[model samples]
Target: MECVGVRFAHSPKIYDYRFGSQAPPVGSWVVVKTPRGLELAKVRTEPRLGQAVGEIVRVATPADLDQHSKLKNRAEEVYWWLKARLRREGVRAKLLGCEFTLDGNHISVQYSAEQRIDLRRWVSELNRLAGARVEFVALGPRDQTAYLGTLGACGMESCCSNWLQDFTQVSIKMARDQQLPLSPEKISGPCGRLLCCLQYEHQQYQELLAELPRKNSKACSLQGVCGKVAKLNPLAGTVDLVTEEGSTVTVHKSELRWE
Candidate 1:
């Protein structure tokens, strides 16, 4: 049950593989047999006790690395060629990237389109031209954005393209619980989805909110003054109370008791 996590090129997701006879170090490259074909992947985590989906073929040799580099260049060429061909044929698709298996027996072409495209003819032509199997992969908005990386609203690289290995469920409720503005422009990432970071500190925010008085609830301050809870500052651990004297005052949560 010993397994290690491996990541493929141009993707952040990691796959667990069992190293049958090889002990590939972290950050090293290894050849693994995927469902599609034999692929070169980087070791992202050290070997640990876990379930593995696939088995590593072997540690990648220097020749394997060289071959991978050449295939990468060739994939770039094929991608451009396919892009131009698609444009000329008026095909409504955006080519994201192209990759070849380490053994050069298969080619994976990533693309995004509004609808399914019947590219049987193109696939055949590419197969004959490259002398390898060609397959098109349809990508969703999030995967498309991950393939073609861009800066995020935080002026840094998007998390999906950076170090995030898997996409998690992110909801507007997380933003609301964190007291963030509900504006889509402010909360959505380049993928036109809720920002992934919104879920990072959500649990902590929820815990803090549980200890604070709900808005519009009756509460008494430490000085024996009573007021209605107006607003909450979860981060600051303070609440804005509108006093019965018609004044808004900020008081720490510890200084207030809910009625």
Candidate 2:
């Protein structure tokens, strides 16, 4: 027996459509066994020989596609229902995404909230109301962006939904490199994700720091000694000096009356 593989449309699970000779036709919907349960899925990649182990029952007709389209198109309505339902239940959840399988047998609802919510009862209510499989998926701030998506501050498409694959941890160091204020609002995005551009030019600023002086090497004429290099404006060519006399003096970088 020859095996064929098909990738899922929106999931990580891959299905192998079995055939004696050829691959399954494209745009066909089929049922496959997922770890959780049987899922009605679409065949993104038609099965090819020597593929991974999975079952792809058969190709679906145009009828299945039409039904699936209806279900998929109802995503907004379903999302609204879920939001209202959750609010009523005092769950405080935001509906981030809704997806329906090609067979219209499954509905996946993704959401994000500040705290954990026991939504089993709500899920049951949804299933009873919609007459379809209801799945409530919890998501993080970043995952919400990946699912629902929104425009970024740059007035362009969001990175999470468009191109970015992984979210790297950002820190205050990155903000310091770019000489940005340490305020949280300026550095955060709508999704609370760090500004994507923070990582850029960081190394350049770090290298620029290397040519800078060590603190306490210079002195302020007004005050006896400066504590340390509290702040520096390279562009302004000004260094804030804290003197030993316990006073602060703004001195020009080029004005070295130090000697």
Candidate 3:
């Protein structure tokens, strides 16, 4: 009933495999039979009884790792080769990354494009060169971010690469709720979509926003203005108010009362 959580090579997503007859240690590299093919994946967490997406094939030996590396070494070559062919064949797509199974029986590609591409010829050429089944998977904004990981604007490894297993729909409202810069470069991650991290404190922001009075609502302030609440800072517990004389003043939340 136990299962092993496994991640394949720098991917943030993890899949569970039936422990079956093997109990690999955390961080151990093990061969697993994923739906894609035989892949060598790392044991990502402590084993537990859980549903599994696939089953462990065996503990990956040094030989297995060496072969896996050899196949991976061909990634750049395969990438360039496909890029050239796609161009020659007038296939319009941006190739993001390529993955090879541990057994070198299959190669999966991630790409993006504005329109659907006819890939039968492309796949055949790849299958002939790599001697494996070729899979071309379309990637979304989040998938593009994961395939080619990058440092985020926060100056750290992006969350998607480090630990994000799945992406949630991000909205402009989340950015507005957090008072983030509305600029595209500032609000969007390396993925060119709203940063996935924005949702981390979204619920809290929504709760806090609800607790505070809205703009232009009448509120009592220590400044003795009593005109209207202009802005609210939930984290700082401060509010900005406009006075009857049209002067704006800031006051702590403790000094304000809303009807």
Candidate 4:
């Protein structure tokens, strides 16, 4: 026999099902048994590398699909109710989204807030109406992108939703690398997290930096001795040269007309 579990994305939940002889193929949606009830979820990855401890079970039924769809809609409705209720309560926060397990056993609400919130009472009330085990998870900006994502400045789907598995910390130094302006509003996303793409190319820029001379190296030019590489201003393509003789001059990196 084999034991398999349905992996739920965007939430830390899983539905373990018994597979007697065979296992559901990867990425396939299956109905699994849980403490609360049966639920539907896609198999993200194949169950461990080996065969089952028991026999494989049957795939999901048509009725299971129908119930899954209904549960999803109901979860969305519950999310809206929470959103409206929170707004009425004067809590200004973002409702990232909600996820309902296929078994109808569990639901998770993802939210982004400025600070801590006491949603215990509200969550209990929701469970009474939802008639299921409810889990409220507080999501940060990066987690928000993982749950409820949108397009980025590059006009494509968010990296967090599509490819980024882990969220790496982002800082202002990254903005300075590609010559981006130091404006936080321009560099940050709606989630207020650093752009995911920053981590992608930082190494390339760092590698390219090795070939370039330091900004403080003195330049011995025919016109005079310059104190340091004042700037590699791309727009000007010039390094502002400060002279040992108390003079400042600009020289192009390509055209060292200084000679």
Candidate 5:
């Protein structure tokens, strides 16, 4: 079946929809019947490879865009309304935002919390105010950051919010392999997990590290000075060696020997 990539907002997620008859051009707005409801989404790409469980209703027109904008604005209002209501009810949760269906028939709210929140009343109140079905989507701290978005420690946009479609497991081993500061504050990102960028050059680091001796292992320089492998700089292709007298010297890995 022919597939298309449709996305409702600036979110990184794109949904695949089967459009057997309505193959619209990329960047065109189209109404799609998602499991949530009728969603007004933009055609990001054609021939998208995925399970197309949903079907395209029709190509959205100017009036549809106007209506979508108005409903989106109302959805934003509902987000704040829910926030205030939660605060008044003393519910512990952080509201990320709301995604409203194209026809304003349903709304899915993304939020984060430490524990389960009784949002049945909140959902009812929102449905009453919105005149639409309201859903609360529970998210992890990382997924919350991905949806709400924030600048990363690298002075750039968060990867997950921008281009990272899926998250990979990150661990302290990646940090140690990269020889970065082991401090949580230094290694952790806004998601309170290891920075996603740590995995960027990790494979290269692993390959380079394999070619060099491990730290604290026995190694000697070309000058016959041998002690322990103090530090390894893969980028510079040099290894810092500590002599028997506790003196240290930096030498290229090619000139070092473990024998």
Candidate 6:
């Protein structure tokens, strides 16, 4: 099956959609039929063989673009109104943003909160007030950060907001294995969670660590001087040994024999 990648506004994840006979150029806008209804999405990749979640209705026309623009403005209005309403209702949720389907018949409002909220009563009220079906989406800390993107500590756009499609488990042990500082500010992302990049090179680091002697274990140099493995330089494939004479010497892993 021929499919192309499409992405909706305010989201980084790309979804595959069957284009059928219509070939939309990359970076062009197209209307796609989603479970929620019609949505305006940007073509992100050339057509390829893949399973599609839905089908593209058609390439967006100028009128469709105009309607999409108006829908964005309307969504913004709904966002502010909902924000104020939530405040008045004393809802303990942080509003991330709002999005409207291309047809303007549905609106999705995203929020983040420490606990789940019961908005069953507000759904009907919002539907009547906004003249569209209202959906409230709860986001985790990572999803909230992905929705409202910011520069990472590396001074580049965040991977979660750029191209990361799914969240993976990141552990403190990964940072420790890579010899990174365990400080929260250093190892944390804007999401207040462990940095996703920590796992990128973790396997390579682990492989390197496996080939080196464990820190604080005893090892002998090629010259027959035995010492405790004080520190490891996984990147350099070297280990620092603190000898019985209290002298520290750095040697390649191949030059040392594990004791």
Best-matching candidate per lDDT: 6
Alpha carbon lDDT at 63, candidate 2: 69
> For residues 1-259, what per-residue lDDT tens digits would candidate 4 score against the true structure?
2456565555333444566466788778766554435555566555564343232235777887788789889988898998899889998778877767776668878777889877777867888878778888888777777676577888887877765656787877877766676777778876776786877888776665443445667664545445676655544455677776767777765544332
Candidate 2 lDDT at 250 equals 77
- Which candidate has the top score in TM-score? 6
Residue 61 local lDDT, model 6: 97
Model 2 per-residue lDDT tens digits across residues 181-250? 8787988877886776677677776666554444556654343444456666554656677766767777
The true-versus-predicted C-alpha distance at residue 105 of model 5, in Å, is 1.7
Candidate 3 yields a Cα-based lDDT of: 0.84
Q: What would the TM-scores of all predictions be?
A: 0.89, 0.62, 0.92, 0.72, 0.92, 0.94
Residue 33 error, candidate 4, Å? 6.8
Q: Candidate 1 at residue 236, lDDT?
A: 92
Model 2 off-target regions past 4 Å? 1-65, 214-259
Model 6: per-residue Cα lDDT over 134-235, one tens digit each? 988999989988999888999999999999998999999999999888999999999999999999999999999999999899999889878999889999
Per-model CA lDDT versus the true structure: 0.89, 0.65, 0.84, 0.68, 0.84, 0.91
Of the pair 4 and 5, which is ahead by lDDT?
Answer: 5
lDDT of candidate 4 at residue 143, scale 0 to 100 = 76
Which consecutive 10 residues in model 5 have the weakest lDDT in total? 118-127
For all the candidates, what are their Cα RMSDs to the real structure? 2.2, 7.2, 1.8, 5.5, 1.8, 1.5
Per-residue lDDT value at 127 in model 1: 86
Clashes of 3: 0
Steric clash pairs (candidate 2): 225-243, 225-244, 226-242
Q: Candidate 3 — which residues are off by over 4 angstroms? A: none
4 or 5, which is superior by TM-score? 5
Clashes of each: 0, 3, 0, 20, 0, 0
